[model samples]
Target: MKEIRVFNNVPVLEDWMIDKQVEKQIRFLKAVHPQLTDIHWNEGRVELRPLKRDPDMKDYLRSYGAWHFNEKDVAELKKFLQQINGKGVDLYYSAFAFDYSMVVYKKDGTKYEKGKVNGENALFTSVLAADFDGITVEEFRREKQRLLDLDIETIDIFTGHGWQSIILLNHRVTDKEILKKFTELMTAKGFKVDSAIVDAARVLRMPYSFNCKALDKKTKYYDPVSPKIFATTDHSWTERRYHVAEVFERLNSLPDVIKQSDALTDIDVKAISTAPLTNTEKKAVKEKAKREIEEVKQIKVETLKAVYSMLDFERLPEAVQKMLAGSQEGLRNKVMMFLIPFLRNTLGLSIQTIKQIMMLWGERCSSKLDTDFVQTEVDRIYGLGFKGKHGHYTEELRKAYGYLEFDKYTKRNKIIIPNGFFEDMSTMSDGAVRIFLAMKLGESLDGVKNFSKADIQKYAQVSERTMERNIKDLLSKGHVCKRRGNRRKGEGHVYYTNPYFNSVAGFTMLENATVKLMLSDLTDGEIKLYCFLSKIVGDSRAECWTSQKYLANKIGKKGHDSISKMTGSLHEKGFITKKTIEKDGVKHSVYNLNY
Candidate 1:
């Protein structure tokens, strides 16, 4: 006889074999039945069952039930097997213990009864198996080779007396009808598929474990064989197993194994345990959406009042305009904080209206504010009290919105350019007007003041080229004089405001610090409007009673609305406040200085 490798009628599983072979089977088992709560194995037999809750494992095991397998139970299992190696114990494991149940119905609409079966239902998955009884080892090997030739990947396990080969699917198959059809197809292919094993409670020999056979009163233990040679093996198999994507690709390649129609049809709601929403639920959802849309539209319409109140909103500097329009959440929130009070106190709008409008505005932001955050902000504003008479506009609010800050210039150094100087400069480029103002507000106490090109460029918010062009225009127009600095040392040119200009008025009687701080954040149009208001208010009084038409004429703007809007922008920036004063049965706005 060819040398048969047997160890004293006992099969010894080496540590390396357990690591390589037995561990792989355990992994595949876990992958197949990941929801398996409990598994049972005995010294001479193996049984796997899902843990029942009430009785518990300790009670069931005491009643001669198999040992339960948990995450940590694998080590205990290996140790038990090692101790019972020569004691005539054989290991078997339950297969197909999935969460889903497959039921077979009889003609009476009741579950079909079977003999010696725990239940008519079975746990079905992607696993497909075929039994080859009364077949020699050589014949079984040839059958496996034939399946390989046909490009069908499978795992073969020797059951001591017979063989059982299984087809590992790309994914788990849970549909009962599909499982039934698959089994029928396998039977048609001349493979011995056990129809009785379709039930939930079924067991198969645990691969890599001993298979004890008793013949003529003599016992012999045979080692189960499980070799890694399959294209569609479970990824939990070896160290370098197939990935889910590869498994899907392999599954797609097998048209006969899984028909496209069957695969697509099986993806219905019944397959995923989800039901379609009822018509009543859908109608409720639609109504909610419609209500939300109407609310947003109403809020947007109301907010237009606050937007229109910023009369010189369009006349604000490009940077200020961008800060208002751009999606900077913090800056936008700060703007809202100042605007809410302005609308309530200055414009006299109600809190409820402001809340709705601000909520919608927050929603329109680039990074939309959450409803809770918007609500919190509205609550904060409410807590501050109405204070409709007292103003909430502050330097902090202006600075928070990226308003430029001006260096404090002393009152003695104030240069009072005539109202006509602004009128004449307004006709030039905005940059030119800004540069002239920058030169006028320098550190010098009188007449000629020294200002670097960098200082003028920064104050004017212009590029180097634009600053140069504006400076040239100012010099050509006799508004200022420029003395070039040392070019080699990278020094800037010095600029001096022309004191002898015909339109030049005496030094401004108002506080220089107030004028500089107010002018720092205003546009050319705003500056012109502020100058007209200053002339009207005079140096002694803080308020000026005037009509929009009068301000419009002074600013050279034809539209009274334009004048009102410019005044609003001035009001918004804390330059001036406008209150309606009725005289001779006619309402006129009295502009007051808030500086």
Candidate 2:
């Protein structure tokens, strides 16, 4: 068995060496206990008793021969150490009360329960000893390497009989729960942790102190195994100490221990039962949350409604309109299947209301929709909710459904047309009327306004063939003039409308409110009738005399009854009044304008 030498009695230190060691010890103590004012040294036993910096501290220091040491005491301490050499006395120092607490093992090597210190908010430095009965030197070396791998800065000390690893923590870890969890983790990671050494009252052997346990009477030094500078925080201080802030940070980052079996571990059932919410209060909170959701939903719905309303459905191609109307049940189902969610989510329309509208639209289609199939699809869609897949009508669908035209319903950068334009074009086809408006509305009223044939076709939703025909008719009737541009340069035909229509005998200037009502609320047929009546009656005349058949021919209606129904609708809307009149034994309906 290897015998351990516990004291360095063979070499007597020179006066300078003894003074240097004493100064170092004092510096260490001062760093750890900066507030201590009373330090007592008696027969190789040092005690650092702290006193309040008051008159009482001065009196106590004088009486007990305790004083804060300075450079003057260094020589005296060196002399004292030389006198005590080989006197069977061992050098010892009182452990200064640090800003931290640590555990120390008793000399008997007995294990005890881990104890707490008073300053829970105090900072700490930890040390692990591999001096147990069976730990080998190789095992200690391996443990040191392991701590290095964990990024823990360690100060290795050869403590005469064994090894000690010191780690300094930078921050305060005041919570006991945190400390317990940290220790548990360290133990799990194969560390030889001294759990009982966590007490604040524990003292540690000072570095460079002489151990008196050697049977050979030779003094063994409690020296640092590693360079002192390497052991300090950031390797910046020249002391046998280290900052293990990184290790503490890693420990803190570990996931909190979760108790799996106890579901009610966190619940304070007694407190909850004592302060339960009233039924009315709970209901109010639920309602408030629901209202907030509904308000957000409403804003989204309004935005979608605006986009849908901007589409000119009436101007779509005939085939596309037929598809939308469900002329083919298969095609209609495919289209409506995609559009239903948009109607529900964007317009906030009820499923029942959407079904009703689809059913009505189907009647106008070439083939009516299947009610059973429609009902089933709507129910299925409502169950799926909105996932953004079918929440919008694509551009392809818009073109196929005859919504590609730019009309009053379409959003525009700007639209400027004379009030008389509509009245003058009342007798034309809807396509022609829209084309004429498109020509005039491109810019502000100016001299010789120009419009390309392609632009007119796009805005009016008319075919090239139809556009040519409309331009020809307008030119022949003296409604507009056309100028051809160079075809090689991709220039198009330029057309200009007459400042005023010659055929319109008089003009009726309508108010902004009236024009808005006509554009947004009135049907095409109603608008045509109102424009015709306004022209014939002029602002001067209140009434006009004409038969339903003649009125039907003027407004392009095929049936006299259709004209009578339009008249009645206009009358009900307060736009016109109707009465019978006779001239030259011929009876006629006289219509009078209300505005």
Candidate 3:
């Protein structure tokens, strides 16, 4: 079985625990959310963060034939088309488990052995269907009626009210891309579709749960088979669909979608959990797993001796001698301590300091393996010097120390070792979030006019896949506002951006970009009007009281002089405020928009 699980996911940066101070805001969010359970009265308003969500799993079931059929009603009816729609759900996590898989169908056409069900039959699922345009109740109601009047046997429509938009997935078709093309073809016939969900054109079955049953008409009994994963599946006996239109058309009762799968799963199974690893423990594990790789064959000892002929410090380069004299660390440090001992006697130095140097160099080991490499280096050090224990050092030491230690052992090397590093994500599948740390750093809206999902990903280092989840997170948590555009580009669709983070003063200058700049559909007239208004406010020394007619003439509208009405509309929008003032003994309304 192809394992597939649908989850309602969200991003981390947008998370916030609501507090008492945000009580009013919580009510506003609840007013818009249809699936909110209840406000945590004692916990304060922070519960709103997870409270705002986009529908995913709830929408999936709405589109499945096995869901919302109400077998109680099915027995009374011959066939039906069920219209299932879901309201937005509270999502603490963007990835909330929706279903499980219980069966596996091998490529070779044999049923998977139930003995290995835990290992071979089960698969963890991650669901991604049609985005916000999935399915709808109003549309399904119309569709079911249409199908019932026809010869259709079965049908399913799933719609999710996620982040205020509907996401629909229809399994009646075998291909999603093809469904999109077909929808477009229908659009040519006066309809536009968001998308289709057929990434894999096959039937899916829910696993573990015995809530579903396929009636075996020939056997005259309910033939129940429960799978582990949640999906649509073809019949075991034939390649045909059960045909749902006949039923929904035959029996016209629509029902509301069921709720959170996470809540049910949490009650029945272990949640997403993993053990963390300590830094030291992790480093040790890495070392133990390391395997040696050789780059070349070793040179014979006789061939090396013939090439060198003699070993003397005077024969080596000046750079080598300088490097050998000053270093301690790495392979070069071990060699230096080896050679310096021989030189100590010849140069008349104390034997005690030389021994101390050798012992000090040995302590530079980062791991037990490094110690072994150091030992080999120490032997090389002995060979490079004169034919005695008191040997000279090599140039390699200076180079190694040059990179490893710069400030003459005078300044203590400050190495910041993390107390621990996380490794639990390996099993969970996210590595420090789905994106990089640098990418997800919160942005200050001081210089931003408008931000896009791509912009969020580039700056926040979040995965593109997670951008949609992040948007709901940012908006629902009140990190941003879901602003509706009245300007030219797009009117009905909502735009989101940080409210508190975005500066109200000179906002256009700060981000150096705005909705007008990013989306091409924004009209030039709206942009011009904004720019003109901004210039007047920016240059004013004090409040200016000017007539609408004068302002209109200044704006170059000679046709009908719409100055008064235009200014009045701006005032009503809260963009500017009107106040009465006497100018040259004449009473006129002056607009104040500083707030």
Candidate 4:
């Protein structure tokens, strides 16, 4: 007898059963992306490379499916699911978001007719993932527990036949080497991690999407009843995203073994370092070494300058100059104490100069000390052998001694123009030149900031059309470069000016007033002359001496007459004061910049 179940006065039959696969897929997508309600979620761009079963190839799939696709916003991604939900195809999404409107090209440098994605266009990777295949559900759970025991957070998934685990990073890792090393470390840890999914553009099965591999007869897990199975989230470790560096350090710290089981020949397990360093780690180490070397060099330079006979007392700090002028009887000894270090450490004065200055100050004191006492005091202080800014008086101590330290008037706002930069700007449009200067002014202590197009327009004071046209020109000329912005903000592209120009050991500083004159008042030819003079002038002197011919060649002009005329114009405009100076019977033009 056939039995029928009745519920709520309605008979439910076996033939009337309904599959809730669509509803399950909707829930799965929501679970993965709970930030769907957040407006910024859509700004993170992604790519969906839909692949259908290849008729000619038994197990392979080709990206020839006809469908409506979009990757601009997170909301758009939901729409994409509807287009391919029922279609007998496999769906894979980019591992990381990308800059908008990124055109992907083929391996041979030809443009793709439709769409292709890879690491070349990735903005950044938030999660480091590993795919372990041919493992049962039980084994997947065991591996999950193993990672938990080690205090590693992960999001584990079951993709029909195998397991995939993801470790979220606190911040994005833009470097590909770091992501690759992560996957390699997983493999080296004796897990059967898939080596091929290391690329930033690598794709994984979309959550809640049908795993079409079950339908392929060539696959080991092909089933008769259910050809397509859902990829489900087995467990989620949502406590926190681990710091990117700490996660890498932790994984590399684990016991590693040479992987002879991987069929991939490209990865040489023996060549890999036992402890791999991310690009960030390598950069930090390099910067630390560079800073230490620079500090030593600076100390040496300051020490060498003490031998010069000319002492510009006005250039010394006001407090130091006053102390050197001598003090009353009550403050003489205290003044001497501070002056010793001020001369030796701050000014890097030679021992002989320090002694001479000390003796001179003692003689000028109201109640003078004995010459022998002054000499002995100087020797005693010098014997302490302080090095590298030791015994330097702090600002608080300076105040207590009735002296103002580190006066604000000594600081200058400087705009650094890399030497030989004029050559790159010669061919740029006037608007591009203005934009470049604005970018220089916009630089912070960290060098450059990620700026949107709107931010740039505000900084450059240009119209939208002007910005669009000249910025494109700047990019084409390689004077500026574009980088991905913070995906959380959905901001426009960030640009870097003069990316290829290498700032050498020498550079020219344009005063704030000089920059205004170059941008607004001075002609382009006059600006060129001014920039060249600014470069050759000694740091201590406002005037520079050069032949007209030398200036002509540097300014990219063929004739000395052009340089002479430009200099005359600059002088007329009160930007410089010109004079003729004779050295070794060679009359050279000397121009003093009026800043």
Top model number, lDDT: 4
User: What lDDT would candidate 3 get against the real structure?
Assistant: 0.30
* Candidate 1 lDDT (Cα, 0 to 1): 0.48
Q: Which structure is stronger by lDDT: 1 or 3?
A: 1
Off by over 4 Å in 1: 1-410, 423-426, 445-448, 465-473, 483-494, 502-507
lDDT per residue, candidate 4, 1-595, as tens digits? 0111111211111211212433443343333322222333343354556665322333333332111222343234444554454455566656665554567777899865334445566656566778877776456655654565455656565665576787754345666555577677777876677787867667777544456665556777555564544444333323234556556555556666765344222343233222243454355446534432121111222432242122334345555555555454324545666677666565444455566667777766654544644666677677676664435554433543344555421224346676655665445555665676667666622245666787678666778898888777578867678988778998667887754456564566654434644655566567656766767763443467778887777666778898889888888776678888888998888887654
Q: How well is each residue in 497-550 modelled by candidate 2, as lDDT tens digits?
A: 776643444334432223334545556567667766665655354457767887
**Which lDDT values do the candidates have, in the order given?**
0.48, 0.45, 0.30, 0.56
Q: In model 4, what is the error at residue 206, expressed in angstroms?
A: 1.5
| Model 1 per-residue lDDT tens digits across residues 1-595 | 0111223344455776555554665665653433332344311112332222211123322101122356566765555444544334444455443222234666689764321123334334435556665576456655654454343545555555566666653333444444344444454444455554454345555655544443112423222342111111221121111222233333334445423334423234224321233353345346534432221111232343345332223332332333334233224445555556654453333344346556656665544544544555556665586675323434544443344321222124344665545455434555566666666655432333577777777656667897887677678777788788879998767787775755435333333444455456787677667766666655544568777876776556767898788888877776676778778998888777654
lDDT at residue 327 of model 4 (Cα atoms) = 52
Candidate 1, pairs of clashing residues: 122-200, 311-565, 312-565, 416-508
Estimate the Cα RMSD of every predicted model relative to the unseen true structure.
Answer: 28.9, 33.7, 34.3, 31.9
* Weakest 10 consecutive residues of candidate 1 by summed lDDT: 230-239
lDDT of 3 at 403: 24
TM-score, structure 2 vs. true: 0.27
